[model samples]
Target: MISCACPEFALDNNPDTRAAMERITAAEADLLAARAAFYPQLGVTVEYNRTNNPMYSFGNILNQGLFTNTIDFNDPGTTDAIQAKGVLQYRIYNGGRDAAAMDAAINREQASVFDNETVRLQLQANIVRAFCSIVQAEEVVTARQSALEAISASLAVAQARFEEGSLLKEEVLNLEVQQARAEERLIHARHCLSLAQRGFLRLLGLQGAAVQLDAQGSPAQEIPANPDINRRPELQAMAAQIRMLEAMVRQAEGGHAPTADLFGSYQVDRGAEFGDGSGNSWTTGIRLNYALFNGGRTGAEVERAKALLREAREKRQHLELACTLEMEQAVLALHQEEERLKVTAKMVTSARESARLSRLRFKEGLLLSSELIDTENRLTDAQLSHSLATASRTIAIADLRRAVGLPQFNHGK
Candidate 1:
């Protein structure tokens, strides 16, 4: 018998799980970007304007003979102007648009968080399933190897009897054939074990990492009854989406409300000859603007927002139904697989004993070689069935955990 325990497989150390956790970091970046909208925006401008023929001569003509009548029309002078301003434009009041937008951004960030959580749960489920498969495959390899050894012993006995002219050549051939078949099964089981190992490694996101599986023990906990779906990330994400949609609706409605902003500006101008060669002036005031009408555009936008809200509500309902059905199915499958595993375990023991007795009887020249071969084949089938049943049960339990929003292989006793 193989003495190794089942392997310890958990998503806590998986690279995919780690990557999902990093999504929160990205969400934080988005939150920062959204908050920046409340800050002021600054702008600077520089201009070098040159006019070949200037209109300043008109003002000069009007001042003709007033002081000194001397028409000195030389090359038009170029005006080089540089202006810099620090603008502080904060929405003192907006039809609640800014608040709605900020709320929407916050909701979206929350949704991202839930999405990451859901991903972690999925990874955990996959890892548990793959790990269980590896264990089951290892058991199969061991069982097949044991059967091959038994068949080898029987074949040797048959050959010696044939050399002593007590057993026919046909009997020896039958035993050899059974031994070959056992060898084939062992080879196939080894291949299956290799495949399972690769699958486990891939699920852990350790594609190139050098790792070996250390079998632990069978899962100790049973599936929970009546899982709380409210804690599920999928449901939480849906809730966040609904909140985001509500924010969008409010933002659209805010478009119809009045917006207030405070503005101030200063300008400096220099003149060549007219009166007041240089002047500086500043003005500050509050402005209120409202979109009185826009050819039904704002009204259509509000309708569209409402339509989207309805769609989101419907989607949430559908998801709730789907989750409920999946949970039920997973629970049923787990029970079924558990029962099958128990039955197959019993079958393996009975078949092994029958094969051993048949081989011993054939060696005593009391049973036909054909009977021994039949028993050996039955033993192989029972071993394979038991292995498959165990693997299926493990997969079912992992799926049940996922359906109920529990961590993969939580197996918390």
Candidate 2:
């Protein structure tokens, strides 16, 4: 015996992912229903009737001492009839409607599988993007903390200089303002981090569980070569649609062909009379039906089916174009984001050096508190920009993968 746990209540597993699997199961069920069309049908029927008067009749009496025998009948309050029939009907021939229907069902099932895959891929991409956001926010918090420390040190120096009448009160006030701003940024960064974490947990369908994510930053992976966008689930789904429509067209064309069926049935009946008698009956026959004309209705249906097939094809073409454009845009965006990240990284280094130099000069009474505060703000901005750029690049890559039907980061491994 095999035991399976229900995934519906699994907290660690994503519900969207589970739903995608369920959709495939549902499609299988549909296919089963379609298969049932090829099986025989069995039915039972019962009927009852009541009559106030009953007819009596006497058959010819045999010559025996010149005597005639009469039969009398009593009216039953109600009469009951029951019949059970097992009918076996098979299509000996048709315009090809049955075959077309089966083909359409198969295409529909295939499309459903593709749709499920598409959903799964999309959800995986979302998870990657959300995780990236959380990491970026955490980095921002660290950068803000560093800026806060720098601002606090500058304020302390400004206070000492003011006490010695070497710095103006306004200079100390400016340093205090910078410290407040840094604290505000840190608070905002923390809030953003919390939100991102919660979103990630929700995507994994773990609402109440605490999550700890590994935050090791590594160089981005190289893009895969020669991605076949046509094989993407989205495009595959569209292709399936076109195939299904073609099947429909074939079915409609079959409407103009003759249909034939072979059927057989057996029945038994019982009668209550002077002498109870039972009888059995059997029937076997073939039926031929042909729709010679239907006032142009069949023609209209054929045309309509053809139109739908064409529409599906056109829609697929449009989607292919759109996908190509999106892929190109994503590639360009990733490149731009990567370049910006490099520039911001350099900026952060430069700002850090400038801040360090200004702090030392201020402590020696060679620079003002304002200069140190400005450098600290510049460093904070540069760090934040770098983090944002990195997040953007990560998200862009995920998007590109999704557009081309590639798997997101490995969740199973």
Candidate 3:
């Protein structure tokens, strides 16, 4: 049996959880990329060209120190030049665009972390439900097996009485019919158990593995008197999303501010042969840019970002409402399942006692065969009901853990 007391048994291997982890990594990478704007950018290029294009040829000759009075101004003739150049640029100012972008990326990474927590919480709840199902199914199968054993025992006694000419053949035949039916019931219960086991295995990502479920029931859980889910991961995720959107709005607004950058370049050129021209030259300066007109694109982008921010805030509001509703619903469900379990436990006790008395009465010729069959069925049904009620209570507690954002459930005792 797989132990769900620790999430690593399933969580580290689950496909959904793995995908969430990847998303977290992706978000972190995006944050790193955003922060790159704070650093200098440098590029190097080396190229050799042979051309007679008027503009480039003249510039190349001047750069290579080959421009002389002897060369005809009208035609510089074909020339081959090799130039190696490096440029460096660093943004001096851009309002707060870079800072806002970095903030947005940080918030996005936070949102991804919360999202992964949400996935893990839901997965824990699902594992609990599946584990409960397997446990319940196993109990049901055992109950049916017991009922079948009781029926077979009664059938044997009836057969002996019929052979001794004391009991009617019809009575024996009725018992025989019920015995067969009880066997069918047992077979079906086992089938359900097998299916439940398979589902549990699938949840743990252990498909086609040999199945064996723990028959031990989960420990009783006390529903918190004032269960609150204000700190649920989903709500936190939405809040992070809203913050990220707010940063995007700020980033957009920064677009209207003029941008300034410091730039420098170094170049070396060769003409006719390598290293035959002006050895090296360097240029450095500060540049400024402002988009005086752009068909209203910048304004449109700012408006769009504001709109998205507004939408995200509204979504967060909706998420808060959802979290409240989920918490209330989970509490109510736990309460109901607890009461149901209590009732079913009493029912099983009463039915088991009744079945036992009926069996004694039938052997003593004080009860009809049909009445015995009815009592047997009632006992089996009560057993199944109690098992179902227990499983339901376990599942409800798991859901409460999920609603409240607990790391993982601890139903094991």
> What lDDT does each candidate get?
0.73, 0.74, 0.84
lDDT of 2 by residue, 173-254 (tens): 9888989988998999899898988887777776666656554433344464765587689899898879888999999999
Candidate 1 TM-score, C-alpha based = 0.84
The deviation in Å at residue 300 for candidate 1 is: 3.0
Candidate order by decreasing lDDT? 3, 2, 1
Q: Give the per-residue lDDT digits (tens) of candidate 3, residues 290-360.
A: 99999999899999999998988888888878888888898889889999999999999999999999999
Per-residue lDDT tens digits of candidate 1, residues 78-153? Answer: 3222233334456688888777888888998899888887887787677667767777888889888988888888
TM-score for each model: 0.84, 0.86, 0.94
Worst 10-residue lDDT window, candidate 1: 59-68
Query: Model 2 scores what on Cα lDDT?
Result: 0.74
Stronger candidate by TM-score (1 vs 2): 2
Q: Clashing residue pairs in candidate 2, if any?
A: none
Q: If both were scored by TM-score, which would come out higher, candidate 2 or candidate 3?
A: 3
The alpha-carbon lDDT assigned to residue 131 of candidate 1 equals: 69
Q: Which stretches of candidate 2 lie over 4 Å from their true place?
A: 1-12, 46-80, 217-222, 293-296, 410-413
